[model samples]
Structures are given as C-alpha cells and as structure tokens.
Target: MDISFGETCGCKGYSVRSDILSEYGPSMANSCGGGNFVVFMTILEAFIRGRCDLSDPCNRVKPHSEPDYEYDFIVAGGGTAGAVVASRLSENPKWKVLLVEAGGDEPPAAAVPSMIASYWGDPAMDWNYRTEPESNACLGEPEQRCSWTRGKVLGGCSVTNGMMYMRGHKRDYDDWEKSGARGWAWKDVLPFFKVSEDNRQIGTLVSSEFHGSGGYLTTQQFPHQPAIAKDILNAAEEIGYGVTNDLNGDNFKGFTTAQTNNRNGSRMSTATAFLRPASGRSNLHVMLNSTATRVVIDPTTKVVFGLEFMYKGKKKVAKSSKEVILSAGALNSPQLLLLSGIGPKEDLTKLNIPVIHHLPGVGKNLHNHVASFVDFKLNKENATQSLNWATAMEYMLKRTGALSSTGLSQMTGVLNSKYAEPNGNHPDVQMFFSGYLAGCSRTGQLFEPLNTNNEDEKTTISIRPVYLHPKSRGYLTLASKDPTAPPLMYPNYLTEPEDIDVLVESIKMALKFGESKILSEKYGIEADKTPIPECASQGEWGTDAYWRCMVKVATGPENHQVGTCKMGSPQDSLAVVSNELRVFGIKGLRVIDASIMPIVPSGNTAAPTIMIAERGSAFIKNMWNWNKPPIVHDHFSSTDLKRNCGGVRTDTNDVKIDIQTQEREVVDWHKRHVHL
Candidate 1:
C-alpha cells in the first residue's frame, strides 16, 4: 500500500510512518473495534490536541475579571434573548452593560449537533425542571410528571435545542396583535427576524425577501444528511404534501429539510453569535456562574434599581443606572419577578413576602407546544451509526459526517389538522422525524431488544406529531421562598378534550407518511406493534380510543414554553408587560425573553425569542435616544407618549412618537439595511 506522508501528518511535530499508517488506516475504517482502531483513535486524539493548540483566544468570551459595581444596564440571565439584549445595548460606548448568567459557558460537547440528547438530564447543562403531576397527561412518566429540560448555560435553551430556525406562520404574530399586544403583527416583527439572521442560503435555497445576509447569527442547512432524510421528503410528497426548499418562506405549510442555527456544521448559539462578538467591547461585562435571586425594587416608587444575585457562594448586588432587563427565560423570569414581590398580592402575602406591586398575571397563562411520538419499524438495518470512529474521524478532519447533521431528525412537516381551517397557511400540526425510537428503560437501555439475525443493525424510527396550538393553559408559582428552589410548574398538558382531539388527528396525519408508497415500499416501514399496556383496554389496537389513550400516555412537551410573563395591553388584567416589554406597574424594568410572548407561536420559540430581544433593544434605544438621530417633525403629534413608550422619558430633545409611527420607521430603517 503506497501511503504517502508529507513533512507532517496534519498534527504538528508528529510524523507517521507510511507502513504504520497504511496498516491501521484501512483497518480503522473497516471496523469500529480492534487494536488498529484503538491505535488510530490515539493518533487522532494527538491531532485534536494539536488543533486545540492553534485555537485563538479571541474566539471565546472571557469572563470579566473585574466588574464595576454600577452599570447603565444590568441584564439578568445571559441566555438567548439576554445575550442579544446585552450585546445590542452595549453598542453605545457611553453605556456599560452587565450580563449575569447562572450557568457556565457551553461545554465542548454542545458544539456537536448529534450530541443534543446528551444535555437533557445533565445538571451542568440543563435546569432539569419537571412539571407537577397531571391526571390526563404524562401517565407513562414516573409519578405522572413530565420532564422539562431547560438550558442553564450562557446561551440558555439555544445551546441545548434542536437548532431548527423556524419563524412560524405570519398569522401567528398577527394573532398576537389582535389579542391586545399591539405593534407585534408579522410585518412589524419580520424585520427583526431578518436582521438577526445571516442566512448562508439566501438566493439559492431561501428567498431574499424573507432572509438576510451578513448578520450576527448564521443560518444554514447541515453540509451532510442521511439518505433516509431524502426518503422522508419523498414520502411527504407521496402523501400529497408540498416539499418546500424554504419552510420559512411563502409556503408555511409544507415539509422541508431543516435550516438550522449552524455555521460550518457546528451550533451557533446566541452566546457564540451575539455575545462573543461583543466581548471585545469595554462597555460589556459578562458574569458567569452567578444566579440572580431577586430584582430589588423600591417599594415607595415601585421602580427597579438593582438586582440581587449570588456569585461564588456570596450574595452580591449590581446596581442599574438606566434599566434592569429580565431575560431569564419563561420559567425563571417569572419566578424572579414573583420573588421580587411583583406578583399577585394574595400569593405574596401567603409567602410572607411584602408586595411591591400587586401584579395578578406574573406567572399565569403558561403553555407549550406538546407532541406525541409514534414508533415505526424498518425492514432494513441501520447502515450507519450516529457515533463511531469513522464518523468521528470524518467530522474531525473535514467537518462532514453524521455528526455534522442531525440525520432525519432535521426533516420537518407543517400541516393543518382536521380542526384547523382547510387549505389555510397556518398549520396546527408539525411533524418531526427521528432516526431512532427514543424509548429508554430505567436503566437507559432500549425498551425492546434489537434483532440480531441480520448482519446489519436493527432500526426503529419515531414520527413525532407536535400539536402547535394547545387551548389548555397552565401556571407556575414559587415552590418555596428559597431562590435555588425550582418553581411549581403545572403545564396541564391535554387537560382540555379539544387538545386531545387535535393530537389524535395529528397522529393519524403522521401515520399517512408511513403508509406512503415511497416510505412503505422502499424502506418497508411499518407501525411498531408494541402495545401500550395501559392503553390496550381502551379499544382495539389502532382505534381512536386506543390512540387517544396512547397519546395521553406518551405525552411529549416540547421545550418551546411561553406566556408566563405575557405581553399585553394594560387593560388586560393578565398583562405583565406592555408591547414595549416594560413591566406594567414598574419603571426601569423589562422582560425581553420568551416569557413575554402573549401566545406561543405556531412553531419553535427560539427564533421568535431572538426577534423579541431585537425589538426590545430597539425600544430601549428609541426611548433613551441612543442609536438613531432624533427626527423632529412639527406635523407629528404625540397622543400619549407615556402609554406609547412605556412612560420612559427621553433626552433633552423631548422627542415623542406614537408606537405605530416609531415601529414603522424602525422597520423601514431595517429594510433599507437588509439586502432585500
């Protein structure tokens, strides 16, 4: 074997003998387990070490060694939206921004797309929140409680999510506008979404009208995908569904390959995209491994002045001269608000905490996109393993392999169920395809044994039918007065009979793809016959009653939780924040994350949450008169500047503009900057 080795074998200061390389390389590629494979992996580790030696310090956000006691802005929670808000707010040299995150930075494993499952129950990465017991849902889970895994790292859930960049149907935001959250219509929020995205496939794969280029966050499809992904797309087409190139474009209801928040086959979390870019700014200071216990508000003025946090096991306070933004996400944001005495008076009194503001809707209206998984068995065996020496070598050398992509898990279908309007753009059901059945026993082994007769590996896939719009609402409250204690989360999944009906219809629709000629004939896909022991007595195997019983037993709550600190008009009693995201009865305080969502969007919440951060940052800048030059027009009349801009007073110019006029101007400004 004529194996050629140059001066070095990719690794610096390391030379490989042709004879040794020739012998081991071929053997490593042929089998996963062998002395040759072990030797090759040892050599690969040296190569990885050499590559790590060449890493640039500028790529990472170093923790601020010494943070000032006071800053112009104090952002609580350095998660998804919090990172964006801190970065955008620190753009001005005059303002100092402090970002406090409870968790540390994202680990090395988080960069790999296939390693997403590794973070679910990990205490270092996930908050590991579980919902309170529900009668109708989570029947199969231990104690009938569903596990809610939220990211605790700097990037928050973005660091631990599937990375699908879905903006949802335009009607989803329009519905928010109709329901008291004025100026949140699709047209108003679309510019922010475009500005935040730096899509790698603008003119080629996606429409220029819907995507932007040269932005902070990079959005692109993974370089490689499994062969089954194409089959899934074909199956969707065979089942009378449109296969689209861009799911976020004109046709919202369709099946498409995933466009994710990735750059060069790695995850581009908000911390990586937004915060790291702003790390060089002297005005921005990031404090990691710190938990914000409470927002200190003046009882007399009902104004937030500073935040109380614990760092290095000692309580500390960071004063905010301008504003304090709560971007701690849905669960923690409201929990922090209640701890600061900004919730219902009755609840605060019961906890013996003095109420600074009697806000009745601090932790109300909690809900999420719930799903149910249906297992399918393939006649063939798994040709490739997700994690193996070959895949590891390919990814390490060329950044292309199974590790580069999420396989068929990235293929998604958006369709309306029988309950939704026929032939409408809005979709009620979103289908997720997985390459493996996610069922695991208490010992973390597969529930069913693999068929060992074939030479290849046995394969079992899952089709998840996500009910996008659930009518049932839930709430969250303080489990205890202790800041470290987890909140009592009552997701109340499938409490309403209508919610179960939607899931049933969605499940049937997903089963159609398995029955399609392309999937059934080519892949020999069949529904898994494993009986749900609790659901068998409901009806015959495939009946609606049996499926309904199975749906409740196999309830899957997606991580897209929202509406706890809902944004709404002040007239609405449940309104925690105004459209500008300012807390109702408080001054110099805002919530810029997913918690402020009035209603959950039709799809994933990550993209929408980033858009909210962009819009909220603009509101702060506009009110403080920082970024754009004030345009004074005598013809323009301000109806009520207080209500329009959340009662925030501007500079000496005293420039006052209505919410609609300001939003239009901001959108136009962003439009001019964008390529399209």
Candidate 2:
C-alpha cells in the first residue's frame, strides 16, 4: 500500500502526524493527498505507542473493571438508535449503561465520503441479509431475492448508509399520530429531531429555525457539488417541481442538494457523532463483537431482568436493573424479540422456545421504500469518468472535490405522482439523482448496477424513483431455533396492486425529468434503453408498458425496513409497543428503533431512526424521574399550525377512506401543528 503523511501534531496529548511517520519513513513535507488514510494511520500509530486517538472517540468504549457487572440500562445493538440511547442514558452518573454490538469497529474507508459503496456487502461492516424470494419484484436480481444491506458495525446502517440526511414529510408523522401513535405528530417529534442535530449548514443551505446547532449529530451540505446535480435540479424545476433550498426545512417537496451526516469530508455516523463525545463518561460501557441472543425474562412476572449474549465464544448474562432496550434495528430487533420468546405464541412454541409474552406484532408489518432505477447515458464529453487525478488532488489538498461527496447521488426530488395522496398535499415518490452511475469501480457497491454493455462506468447516471409510502406489507419469522441464524425476511415487494400502480406512475414521472429540455438539450443526456432488453423488445422505448416491465424486473427495496414491532394504541391488536415505546404486556423492556414505526416515513429511515432514539431516551429519563434540566427551545419556536396545505391523514383502520377528505384532514393537522 502506497501511503504518505506529513508532520505529526506532537504528543503532548496531540495527534499523530510527522513524528510517528518520520520514524517509519521520510517526512511528507507539504504532502496531503490522503486525508482519511493519514487519519487512520495516526490512530494505528497511537495504538502502537499506547495512546488514545480522538478522531472517532465514540468508536471505543473501554471495558469496565467488573467483567460480569450489571447495569441500569443494557442497550442491545449499538447501531443507529442504540448508540444514541446508551450515550444519552449514561450521562447521569447514577446510571450505568451497557451497549452491546454484534459487529466490530468501523473501518477507515467508512470515513471516506465516496467509498460508501464498498461497505455494502463487506461482512465486517454489513449484516449481508437477503429477502426471501419475491413474487412481484426483483425479477432481474440474483435468485429473484433482493439483497438487504443492514449495518452490523458500531453505527449500524448509519455507518454503511449513503449518509443522506432526510426527515420524512410532516404528513408522515401526522399519519403516525392519526394511526394511534399519540404525541408522534410532526409538532411533537420536531423538537427531538432538533435535539439530536448539529446542523452545520443551517442559514447557508437551510434555515436556522428548522435546523439545530451544537448538537451531537453533525449534518451539512456536500462540499463538492457534481455538475450532473445542477442539471437534474434545473430539469426538475423546468418540469414544475420547485427548487427547494432546504428539502428538510419548511417544505420537504421539490428538488435540492442533499444534506448528509458528514462533517468536512468524513462521514459523521452516530457512532462518531453521538457516542464519541460521550465515550469518556465512566458510566458508559460498550462491548463490540457481542451478539445478544435473548432477553432473560421472569416466566411468572414476564419482566425482562437480564440479557443472554454470545461474547468471545462464550455465552454470558448481563443483568439490567432498570430496563433492557432493543435498538437492534428493523430486522434484528424483531429477531431478538422472537429469540427471547416474546413473539407470536404459535411461532415460539413451534420453535420450541418457552413463550414469555405472546406478542403477535413482534415480527409483523415489515416494509421498506420500494424503488426502480432508471439509467441514462450522458454525453461522453460532459460525463465524469471512473477516476481522475484532479479530484484526487483536490481532496488531498483541501478535502473538497468529487472525492468529498457521497458518490454520484448529490441531488434529490420529492414530489407527488398522479396517484398521490387524497389531498394532493404530500409527495409519495422520491427521486434520487446520481451523476455518474455506472462508470466508477464502486458503482455496484450498494445496489445492483444497471444492466449495460458499455465499458465506461462514468458515462451513466440513474434516476431512482422510490415508492415512499408502500402499502405492501411483509412479515419476518424465525428460520430456525438457533439464535445465531438470521430471520426469514419476506419483503413481499409490489404485492399490492396499489403499490405496483404507484411504482409504474413513478417511472413515467422519472422519464419526464430525463426528457426535460435542461437535461436532454442542454446536457445532451439520453435514456439508456439498451440495458432493459425485455422492455426494449416489447414495444416503443419509454412507453408505459415498457417501463412497467422494467420496473417489475428491476424494482428492489431501499432497505429502509420498519414496523416489525409496531407502536400504536393498546386497543390496536397489531400494536407491540405503545406510544411511549414500551413493549406491551412486558415490564422493563422497550423497543427504541425503527421497528416501532407504524408506517415507514416518507424518506430515508436514518434521520427518523435517530429522532426515535432521542425521544425514547427522553421518555425513559422522564419515567425514571431524573431531575435533568428541561431541554431549551429558544432557537426554534413551535407556534402556529400550517395545516390545509399538506394532505389529510385518515385513520389506518379505515378500509374505505375518502382520499380527498383524508388529505384535507392531514392538511388540517399540519395547519394546527404548523411552526412559526
């Protein structure tokens, strides 16, 4: 490996730079080519010299003095949500928190902005899960089973995700509240979102009223803007979708540059953002490479007291005096719940596990953002190639360039399709724009690359039209009694006729963006029709029939799985957890992750997942009667309700809902909850 470094920052508790690298090799004077590489080497040098490196301080949670010690809170799965929960709970000196993770540390490449694709299938970083064979979608994928990537590392999916930060539309949360999730409306949860965010791009990219600062999670605009992004934004605007300066601000609809969980040039995952700053607390302890097998509950009392886990080839038990929180994410969280015999009684009995609590919703209501990728080949003269010396030098010298971005998808658009919500207030389809889709070596890192014979990878870009509010629901079940095995996931993509209709319409809308004068005439880009041989053979290219065929064959889940452990009113039979996130019929146990969402939000699940954790921690603290100071809300005040613009949301139980009236209800809710 060809690696270089400059002078060290010195060792008076300083970082490693020249001194450590000089003893090993000649000084790199003014050389600054590999910023991420140098940082990784600095940490390695620190470990060798028996010193601590603070670059990602949250990655390390030194073990406590006692090996088999119990804690006030034992947070299983140190992924996106669990990391925040453990970090916040441990703030009180009286509370000892234990965070258990199934994966190891995040690698150096994870910090590099463009290398996100590489982490998709890496066993060390990804859980490498696959959905059961689908009936209506993923026809062109391997074995007709869509690949599902979940982060198994410290930050969970936050460590392996595209790093795009998106809070779902206001109507999304309003629908949650309307569907039995009291206090989860947009107004109620906005504070939690702000509480966790340290928005570095506020005022410049987004408004300060809608964003937060000095918070644990750092979010900012991508430093390097791809030229293709500008084209997409322009074309979207030409097609009537407004160009939103801040997609996460007042109005979430329209096209805009994506805000990501990145600071400077590095990916700022929750493991680094939330946990790193809190790692020094003596009450916090993090255990990596430890899998939680089951939550030990008292059979008669039905209360969780200890957790059984596999650590270093041995099974051990760690007791939690206060509670055992499951932040294991959408897939693993429900799997752990079933493994501990807290699921459907028939399933648990069939698996031969003693039933502690018969919660039928344990692994029910599984769904994700179903999407189709439309590929286009841009003019070679204006296209970005696989590798360029200019970009490498730019990043090395100033941490700004193509290398400083989250790959090609730099801009996104959220808009309502013809088959939109009843009130026509919220957009159901989200389009992500990737400048160079297939040209790069890492093109196929996350999802399957477009089927194309072209040798050049940089000339292609893909417009991903995602069905945000999918109606096709799936379920998960235990594949085996063994705790080490993965659960059987049935995404059942495109099973619902309505879902298929939405996807088909989304494809048509996506074609308009490509046909817009800005992209076709000005940018000289054309739809890559040859990749879809079946669609091409059927009839004229870009037709409804042709696109429908392509969508069916190429459509896959966005991996934003949620609702396995559904949260709802107690009267709701499918409700596993309550609005407070506490599991029904079980004491000292809570589900504080994406699995608790009654419906997957209108955008990426990362931001909402973090918001869930922040609120969950607050709820837990309040329940315990902790005398912490009240959270301040001076920067952004929640005043007026701006309802009647966004659509209305009818109860989820309404079988025959009036689409128009539902939209109106949602709009009214937003008006009431509207912020100043």
Candidate 3:
C-alpha cells in the first residue's frame, strides 16, 4: 500500500509519485481505480537499478591470477585506515609491505572535482552493501534495505564519503579514556592527525592555526560552498550557536565551512596520497581483487603465521614474516577474525569454527554517526549551471563566466552543535551540509551529474548527529563457519533512549536553521514542513520527542563501523586488544582499522581512522611503546580562532533558538548573490 524509495530493494528516485504501487508487485492487488496488472516488473526494475548502487557481484567478474607473496607485513582493506598504516609501516625500506584491496585504484571520475558526485554507490568503487531491514529512513526506496555505500577501491570509504573533516571534541577522547580505553586521549592522538595531513590555510573565514602542513592527505576549504554557508552561519548566530572560525578548534562550538580531503577541486582519497606515491616501489606489492579469508594460525601456539586469501580463484598464502595486521574495516575486519576463530565462543561454535580465542568483544561496541534530514521545497527560478566543472569549463574554454567557480562542489559543512549535556564544554551534535540534492537514485547509483533543475536548488539539509557518548552497543558475528560467508551484525540503534533524544534535537536544529532568513533567500529554500510522525507520537514531543522519532527513522549505522575489536586496558572484559591494538591471545596480529575504535568519534571517520593507523604505526614500531608529542597540527584545537570578523557561534539549542527566532524576523539578509 505504501511505496517507499531510496533504500535497497526499493524504487529509489528524486521524484515522488503518489500512486505507484497499484502498477507493480505480488499477488496482484488492484488498489488503483481499476484492473490488476501482475507484471513481472519489480524484479526486472530492481535488477537493472540495483547494480548502479553497488559492485557487480564478485562471482560475476573474471578472477585475477594468483599473487606472489612477499612482505614483512601485509595489510588487508586498502581504505583510509589501511592506506595510512601501510604507508607509515613501509616507511622503512628494509621492510617489505603488501597492501591488498578487493578493488584496485580509482577511475578518472574519482579524480574530477565535480565528479565527486560520481563516487556514490558506484559499482566499481563502492561496496554497495545493504544492511538488514531497518525500521527507519530510506523513505520511498526499494526493498526497504538501508543502503550502506562503503568503498571497495583503495582509500576505502574516504574515496566515496562526503569529504567533511572533523575530529570530534577533545572531551570525546577523555570519555573513551574514562571508559577504560587509556592513552587515546586527544592530546596523545592529535599528532597522528597532523602526521597524516597536508593542511591548507586557504580560507579567510576559518583560521589556519591547527592545520598541518605538507602532510599526505590534502585539506582545504570547499571548492564551491553552496551559498548556504554564510547564511546558515548568520542564522545560527542569530539563533545563538557559539560561532567559531573552526569546528576542529578547542571550543568545538561554532559553524564554518567544512574542512575537506580535497585537492584542486577533487577528493584526495588515501590511495591518492599514500599508496599511489609508492605504486612503483618494487618492494610494495599491491594486490587487487583479492579477498582475504582468514589469518593462517599455528595450531600448537596461538600465533598468526600468515594470511589465507583468494585472489581470482586459487587460494594463496601470503606469509607474514613479521606481522599480519587486519585493516579490513569495521565490518570485514572482525568478519575475517571471526572466520579465523578469534571471537565469542558461542558464535564460533555455532558456525563450527575452531575456537582460537574466546574474546567476547571481537565484534561488539559498534557506534556510528547516524542522522536525520529535513527536505524543504522552495519556489523555482530558471536553472543555471551549478558551481562545478560545468561552470569551471566556462573559464577553461572562454577564460570567463562561472568557470572560475570554487568547484564549490559543497556537499558538506562543519558545525559544532551542542546538546543539553551537563558538561559545560561538551556539545551533542555535529552538522554536515552536503551541497547537492537527492541524486537520481537513493539506491544510490554512481552519481550522474545533477539535473540542472527547473530552478537553482539548495533543496535540503541533512541534519546529522551521532550520540556523542553512546551507551547503545552493536556487534558483528559469524553468519556461518564458511570463510566466504559474511558476518551478521546487529547495530541495535535507538534501542537506547539517549540516542533517540540526540537525533530529534538535531532535526529541530536543522529545521530552525532552514527557517533562518539568511538561508531561505540564499538558496531560495522553503520549508516542506513534513511533520515527523514519531517525533509527535512520543507524547513528550518537545526536543526530546522529536529526536526519538528521528532516531527511530534514521538510526542505522553510517558504515564508519568500529569498536568490534575494541581496544582498551587488558583488564577490560570486552577488550579484544590492548591499547597498542595487538589482538589478545595472538602474536603478530594487530587490528589497524576502524574495527579497533573503542568508540566512534564525532564526525567523518576517515580522518580519525587514518589517524589511528598513523598512531598505531608508531606504537607498533615501538612494539606498543609509542612516545611522541601531542599530535598538534599547525592548527590548535584550543587556540582561539575568532570568527572571520563576520561570524558568530550558533551552538547550543537555547542560543540557537534566540538567534534562529531573530533570523526568522529578518529574512532577506544577504542583498545580492556573491559568488567567490
């Protein structure tokens, strides 16, 4: 009776057609004004469209030849975390390292500035993973499966993720320390971020204080920031957000242009930064299309000797003369470990797997940056090319026009949102403002260029916020003993009352932000006023009720999956590894991936994930004795960055309400369109 779009197995599209179901599907029901049409159409449509969101099934592709084994350490999953780990560890030429990825490098589209849009659910670049049915968000999508778009190629999710770079508030790390995860404090881990960054102090808006210099990963101001940034900031200031120049700064209370991992208008994935630099190295063996099955362990001693992988068809063994690190990401890293029998005893036994270790936390403590969004429809005007290559081409060819555009390929923002936390310094939400709209499909096909609409659009703002400190925990367990079988994960979201509260507040903030007079005129947006059903039903429908509803709807994982193999002090029960990231009960086995996150950080996981590898490499090099200065970038988190002379801090809900209400009173704040 209800036609949903954008989730897996669902009919996903930008347009909403009211009467769609009567035209399709099982048992032939004719709710439409007349006759039944039992067309075998759903399957065909799904088959055709679904392929756009994910990779072609691995079995369908031709297999590559067997790989030659040569490495002191072989890192699996060449994503954000993997690339950093491999790059750092291999810094020693005396050591040989091999980085194996299921997908190879990226395509030209991945390198294009505006074409960052093409990275979504791209079959070649995306893992196109679907989560088990969620009770929430993928409205109007096919199949109701929550679409999980992870990267398959090198640079992992960073290659495909929205390029927002926010290291969460320092309080976040302190909490992790309080929860038994020691030595992961902000002061200690910041160096890793600095080591991995090539910070650019380009923007006059945010200060260049803490930004790193000449590091591998490129950091910059958005190329083309949808005119929304200033208006949103102004409105947020009116509403009382503690506007700051940088969200990554110490106060963590402000709104500003999002920091990104882009260079010259294109995304700078880790592969582009680290692995690509050493692609020609003879000692660096990079394997593509290879699926690692499990760690080859010694039967007599619980030592991981090598890795068993399937490249093409033949099973191959890549001996780890030194160590076998699992960088297979939050999802697959634990999956690989479980298949190798290093997990919860019950799970391994059920799958008929050998029990190498009885670590209960092998796949527990999952956290994600879950979100909810507001869709506002605005009055339309004649459409013009957006600020990307289409406009950039104008400059390239004619040496004029919108071609000089900043590639303002903005799909992101950086805001330090605050909650009603008792702690004075800590805030609850972090907002990311993506530049584009609902792309052609929510099944998330590789992004085709946006349709130059009937009007210039700033259509919607996705109000994303994670539980700053979540008590709700999730896990990844073995589906079967078979190495090929993927693990089963349950991210028991919104199962907690706190997480529910956080999202509802996030949506309200977004709603208020959109209502700001400055935002409305800039992008020409009008509020859709689509009431959230759950927000109202909780009977406690203030900020708390609204958040609960948002959680119920959008409470799925962001696929920045981690904490499965949680790192903590040895005495911690759920800990599968020490603070050093070495797996318990096993030698030469360390998890240098998102799977080792004791808790998920506040914003985009790529930056922190890479930092983990950077820090982990140091620790591993010292055999867990890494002693270095706080990872301070040229930029300082605590170093005050006054707004760019024209900014305010619109952080807390109370402050935001006051400012938002004022902005509501003054709608047309920006008099003219200023394209910088």
Best by lDDT: 1
lDDT of each: 0.76, 0.73, 0.59
List where candidate 1 sits over 4 angstroms from the true fold: 1-56, 382-384, 436-457, 628-667, 670-676
A best-first ranking of the candidates according to their TM-score comes to 1, 2, 3
Best by TM-score: 1
Cα error, residue 103 of model 1, in Å, equals 0.4
Model 3 lDDT per residue over 1-676, tens place: 2222222212213222222222111111111112211122222233222221111111111122554565688887788888777766766667788777777655433443443444565566666776555444443235445677778877778766667777877777777777776777776666566656666653454443455554567676644554555666687787676466667765576666666776544457777677654554556677777788889888568887788887777788888888888898988888888888888889888878888888888888876666665555544432233433334333222223322122323433334345455665666666655444311221122322234333344344454444455557767677776666656666666567666666666666766765667656655666565556645565453445554555565454566667888888878888988777889889889998877878787666777888788767776655532232222222211111112101112111110113343223222211110000
Cα RMSD, each candidate: 11.0, 10.6, 14.7
lDDT of 2: 0.73
Q: Report the lDDT of model 1 for residue 259.
A: 97
Q: What would the per-residue lDDT of candidate 1 be over residues 191-283, giving only the tens digit for each residue?
A: 788767767787779986887654678788987788778888888888887789987898887899979997667678898788766766888
Which residue pairs collide in model 1, if any?
Answer: none
What's each prediction's TM-score? Answer: 0.85, 0.84, 0.75
* Model 3 score (lDDT): 0.59
